[model samples]
Target: MHFDFTDLRLFVHIAEAGNLTQGAAQTFLSAPAASARIRALEAGLEAQLLYRGNKGVSLTQSGETFLRHARIILRQIDYLRDDFTGSDSDTSGHVRIFANTTAITEFMPEVLAKFLASRPGVTIDIQERLTQDIVRAIRDGTADLGIVSGDVDQTGLEAIRFSTDRLLLAVPEKHALAERKSVGFADTLAFEHIGLHDGSTLLAFLRGLMEKNGYDRALRVKLRSFEAMCRMIEAGVGIGIIPESAARRHTKTMRIALVSIDDSWALRERYVLVRSLAALPGAGRALVDELVQNAAGGRK
Candidate 1:
């Protein structure tokens, strides 16, 4: 005989509470109804599953074995309902987005504001993470979408071209490098470089570039975020190579200068919109459309 989900749920609940009265209270059923369910489930399987006692209920050896499979089946059904049922309702739901520090601080504000204005019912949770970590978050089902600076090598994710981000050499205004309108790659490398922390796409790209130019062995101090690097540069720690978007704010608010790299090796990295090829919720799809539209407009 096959067991229905109702039976499995009743079995698990009764096993947990150890008493039909409490289990019935939890399921909003009377004790009689709950006891009848337990009996029916045991009889259908042609095995004794429970032992009625003066104090509470206990699972028989057969019940103990069946409980394992029953729990697994019930959990899967719950996940199916969670993924499909909420999709049909209002497009109002939560979207978890992961973005690198640069995109979150600079490129994402305007686009997110516009999206939120259009979908007032949808809530968004944004996390500032490194590019590699952002990809991992999507792969692990923690985030629905991601905006990253470099290529993510993970399979099962589709990355769409969003916008081109120009890299800039950010220096303090009083620094000697600020006198130059543009700096070359070799010149930037000559300074005490304040490197971005590991796991960042920017850091990875920079390391690759340095390697291509036969400067792979060079070492530098590491910092966490571009914002923190900017403060350190202002404090005369070391010059940093940061995204143009992040550099623009420092140029305006602080005693900092943004200089483009004049090397022919300069590359315009594309900011990409990443989504899992698997199922996505309504709010996630809406946000993706908004991102694509915004990207077409150059993310102005």
Candidate 2:
């Protein structure tokens, strides 16, 4: 029921050498030592593996079957060993990303698609978080990279500027604020508004702005994505503030009105943050490069 790998190798050497002594020499074992091991192995299997004669030993049908299987098993073990011994440049692991809501909804999808197309072995895990939380996660090593916006303290991280993000007021085409060329964040608070789902980074940022500025608040609905928020705004659910890129993009096909925010805080530059870009693992570096390239060329 059980035989060691040594027994298999010894049996194979003996079969190729055409005798026990020569096979023992090949395996660096004495003839008597090899004979004892073979006897034990045969006993364990309860099969006569060799036909011992004056001309030397030859494989019985059982020995032939064992040799064939032994070679296959040895080859697989060698492959496993080689895989573990491969270099760190192997882009075959997981890459963790923490990003803000706009980066997750409006930015990452196309960029990630291009990155994943050629890296069949690479996988990505992304989570949406507030900018400060994303920065903290990257610093603490829980995340490999982060996409964040606005004036966050980046004292110990590597920040690579990737894109500009501007928040705009999205309203129905015939809504009260639709004809306005621009509106202040405080001005929009008087009307009912749509918002992102709870825990969204954009919603948190907007809430902070509303608290800091003198503005009444009314949130009638909360949805998951910018697309959904735009749809709600178009349906006259309420006006919502979302990324300008999303608002403009959605306007091409939806009856949504885009109103510029006069507040300077509404426009912020987004960055890719890492503890140290040069020290990233191969897969991580590749993804960072993909993001930088996509940003420079602009995403479709």
Q: Model 2, 218: alpha-carbon shift in Å?
A: 4.4
Q: Which candidate is the best by TM-score?
A: 2
Residue 3 of model 1 has an lDDT of 66
lDDT of 2 by residue, 36-117 (tens): 9999988998999899999899999998777667654553453354357672353566677989888888879988888888
lDDT of 2: 0.82
Top candidate by lDDT: 2
Distance (Å) between predicted and true CA of 156, model 1? 4.1
* TM-scores vs. true structure, each candidate: 0.60, 0.69
How well is each residue in 1-300 modelled by candidate 1, as lDDT tens digits?
866777777787788789878877877788898888877877788999989999999989998878767755664464466577764322567776878766776767887898888777778878777777778766655566888765457577777666777778888888889988887888776677777777666777688777776775554577777788888888888888887777787677778888889964454545444455335666677777777788787552
- Candidate 2's C-alpha runs over 4 A off are 1-86, 216-218
What lDDT, from 0 to 1, does candidate 1 have?
0.73
Q: CA RMSD for every model? A: 11.0, 18.8
Candidate 1 stretches with Cα past 4 Å from truth are 1-90, 118-120, 154-156, 195-201, 204-225, 262-266, 271-278, 297-300
User: 166, model 2: CA deviation in Å?
Assistant: 1.3
